[model samples]
Target: MIRSAYSLQAAEAEIPALSATPLDVVALLAQAHHPEAGAVVLFSGEVRNHNQGQDVDYLEYEAHEAMAEKMIAEIINDAHAKWPLKIAVAQHRTGKVAIGETAVIVITSSAHRHEAYEANQYIIHRIKHEATIWKCEYFTDGSKKWGGNCSCCPPAL
Candidate 1:
């Protein structure tokens, strides 16, 4: 369901379920389009080839679907309260994500670039820290470890 502070005709927001299918960045950007919006910000989190010097094979993501959606909606609402946004949308991928694949995407549109940029950054950061999602990383050497803290790598022992 779309969640937005403005009326349906004025804004758009969404939190889609995690899918094995690749995310369509174009479609997400399209959703944030508005005639009055002059600035649009898009953020994509992709699976990289290496992590802490390990040749990563792939990454697995899991989420509490229902709660995650709710948390994302709250984030959208908070963004609206903080900025004058035309629209905002965020989505996260679940299941195995191969190297170079898009894992998460966030789009925000506003009348000014500063608002769009700041709101976009805030939304992505909050989602990483507040959402109930877990990630497990697999390495090429047959070693694996679960990641902690969405903002950075797991703390060293």
Candidate 2:
């Protein structure tokens, strides 16, 4: 018998990996549902049109691909251990991202809404501050600025 994805067991669930392409929100959401999951939470970190009063033309993101992925997986695992999560997935873009485009995404599911919401928040915040990623902002005026993510180390020169 072919079981619905919603009926899949938690052991069948796996952590989502990091990526550098445009995130498919719909696909990610579809992967997060489980029989125990009554609540699903998604976090989309989009590229806004402006930042710091400057018009943003676009954003360029870079990362130590292997390291960032490892860190994110650890964070998600920690969340699962802390909460009753059925599944979790996260991705970060590594190339040019236009305005209103998603730069990062996190999805979490749990039997309860609070668990899903809290775990989703925890994963996104950890990715922002702990992952070895860098961001370069291309302003509308043809200027650019580089900064490290919340990681303690600065972007490599």
Candidate 3:
């Protein structure tokens, strides 16, 4: 929770239930210009029960916290460099998570909607594909599967 000229926001937490990533709060922070910034964009990525047609009982997510945070910081930096972003925030859940829980949220604010949207998308995409995080899947059959690179379970691409 380090505050900066443009807050550096990111977290790796255990998600057990519903999480609120309200646009207004994040937007207000990003749109420090508030009344002057008229547009905001927010994206929430939830943890769904099914993946590749398998019935997911729950998911266990693990990450190299230090590295993951560093990666998120870079993504935010890139978003700012690539867009007219006023504020940026991204969060991801770690540890056990149930179905329908939110795993990630990205919020970006700009003077315009277009820039906000682009920055939001960029942050989410990087978090999903580039973060140093891994997921384990528990299925209805009492079996489990791990992310592609996980050594303790089957490969999941």
- The 0-to-1 C-alpha lDDT of every candidate, in the order given, reads 0.80, 0.79, 0.66
- Per-candidate TM equals 0.86, 0.84, 0.72
Model 2: lDDT equals 0.79
Q: Candidate 2 — worst ten consecutive residues by lDDT sum?
A: 148-157
Model 1 alpha-carbon drift over 4 Å, by segment: 1-17, 149-157
List of clashing residue pairs for candidate 3:
30-87
Best by lDDT: 1
Best by TM-score: 1
* Local accuracy of candidate 1 as per-residue lDDT tens digits, 111-145: 88999999988888888877887889999999988
- Model 3 Cα displacement at 83 (Å)? 0.4
Error of 3 at 130 (Å): 1.1
Q: Residues 1-157, candidate 3, lDDT per residue (tens digit)?
A: 2344323222212211122232233433343333434776767766677777788898778888888887887888888899877677777778887787767777776788988887787787777778887778888889899884322332222
lDDT of 3 at 11: 24
